[model samples]
Target: MLVYHLYSGGKDSSLAAWILTRLGYDVRLVTVSFGILDNWRFAREAAENLGFEHRVLYMPREILERAADMAIEDGHPSNAIQFIHEKALEALASLPEVERISDGTRRDDRVPLLDLPKARSLEDRFNVAYIRPLLGIGYRTIKELTERLFVVEIRESEQLEKADYEVELRHLLRERGIDPLTIFPKSHYQSRVLGWRGQL
Candidate 1:
């Protein structure tokens, strides 16, 4: 079966792809862009290093605008981020070759998490499996696994601007004369994989 893995070029997603590949599944790495500047280049590079076919899916700016509006309305971006993720999965589920959707979400992930109700809803509506291989794994284990498996460049999330969907939304909010800090929580972390060393 084909697994469409949502890739962010971050350690978690990359490791998730690696795990699935080792399991002998046909895995394709997919990155979704919000019509803003993004680190899709890094995602492509990571996919190449992992020896997987990579695809970039562009979500329209309007969709992002709606998500931003949701954040504005709800007074937090977590819900907005989850909305974008669900939309991304829906887009992938439309593909005929995709039998399953996967992401690098770990047990500790809060934002962009697919709650059980949402997962069940998606499965019922799309007839595709939504899998998060790292969901049962803790943050420390994920970090250890990534370090053991790859040579990575860990940096602050701001340094890797545009690497996240929220970046685009923040920019859009700024353009609209709104303060992003009013919506997004302070202090989020993200990373990029420079290369993969054979498993230690």
Candidate 2:
């Protein structure tokens, strides 16, 4: 079966898509964007390094604006990020050709994840199977697996380059003359997948 894994050019999404391939599913990487910045290219290059077919899908720009406002209001990104993520998942599932979809969300993710009710709602509404390959895995195992399978450049969240909502949110904050640090944490480390183990 063909499955589209929401990709962000990071180890998590890349690993999720790669696992789908190993499980005998024809997997394609899909990167979602709001066109706020030319960030999707990072994901495209990462996909190329993984040897997976990749594509980009534009999401509603207003969704990003709303999420950014919410993040600024809340002084943290959790709820806002989760809201954007769920919406993005819905947008992907609503596509007429999408039957199965997947993402890199893990059991340990605190932000940008869908709960059972939302997941079920999506499945019921779109008739799409939502696959989460890393949902059961913890942080340590995920880190070990990513290290074993990918060549990644790790940097603090604000300094790293990866194609995901955080980048655009930060850009939005900056564009409005607000430092992203006011809305996003300055302490987390993020990975930018350089390539597969030997593909670099």
Candidate 3:
């Protein structure tokens, strides 16, 4: 079966794709662009390094705006990020060739998590399986696996500036003369892959 892996060029998602490949599934890497400044180039490069076909999906800015507004109203971006993630999953699930959908979400992931209710609904409505290979793995394990498999670059999320859903929403807010710090909490982290270093 074909698995559409939601890739972000980070350790988690990249590791997810790696795990699926090792399982002998036809895995395709997909990264969604929500009109934010991001390091999507790294995602494409990572796909190349891993020898996987990659595709970029463009999400409307308005959808991101709705999520941002929700976050602003609730005083936290977690719910907003989750909303964006569900929408992303919904879009991926609509693909006829996609029998299963996967992401790099770990057991410790808070925002962008596929909650039980949403997961069930997606499965029931789309007749597809939402798989998270890294769900039961912790942060240390994810890092170890990634380091063992690929050449990755670790940096602060704000520095990369273009790879996250919240980054786009934050940019929108800044453009409107609003401070993102007023909404999002401090010290968020994201990952990037520089190249591949053979397979584990």
Predicted model with the maximum lDDT: 2
Query: Which of the numbered candidates is closest to the native, going by highest TM-score?
Result: 2
Tens-digit lDDT track for model 3 on 1-200? 78998887777888898899888888999988875665566678778877889998888888888987898789888888888888999999988878899998889977778778978999889999998999888979887888788887776666763365766788887887878888876676667776677753
Model 3 clashing residue pairs (backbone)? 37-162, 38-162
Query: Scored by CA lDDT, what does every candidate get?
Result: 0.82, 0.88, 0.81
lDDT digits (tens) for residues 72-152 of candidate 2: 889888887898888888888999999999999999888778889988998999999999999999989888888889999
- CA RMSD, predictions in order: 2.2, 1.1, 2.1
Which pairs of residues clash in candidate 1, taking residues 3 or more apart in a chain or in different chains? Answer: none
Q: Model 2, stretches more than 4 Å misplaced? A: none
For residues 1-200, what per-residue lDDT tens digits would candidate 1 score against the true structure? 78999998878888999888888778989999875775677788877876779989897888899998998999998889888988998988878877899998878878788889988998888889988889999978887898888887775555663355767778888988998877766676668776777632
Worst 10 contiguous positions by lDDT, candidate 1:
155-164
What would you estimate as the lDDT of candidate 3? 0.81
> Could you give me the TM-score of model 1 versus the true structure?
0.89
| Deviation from truth (RMSD, Å), model 1 | 2.2
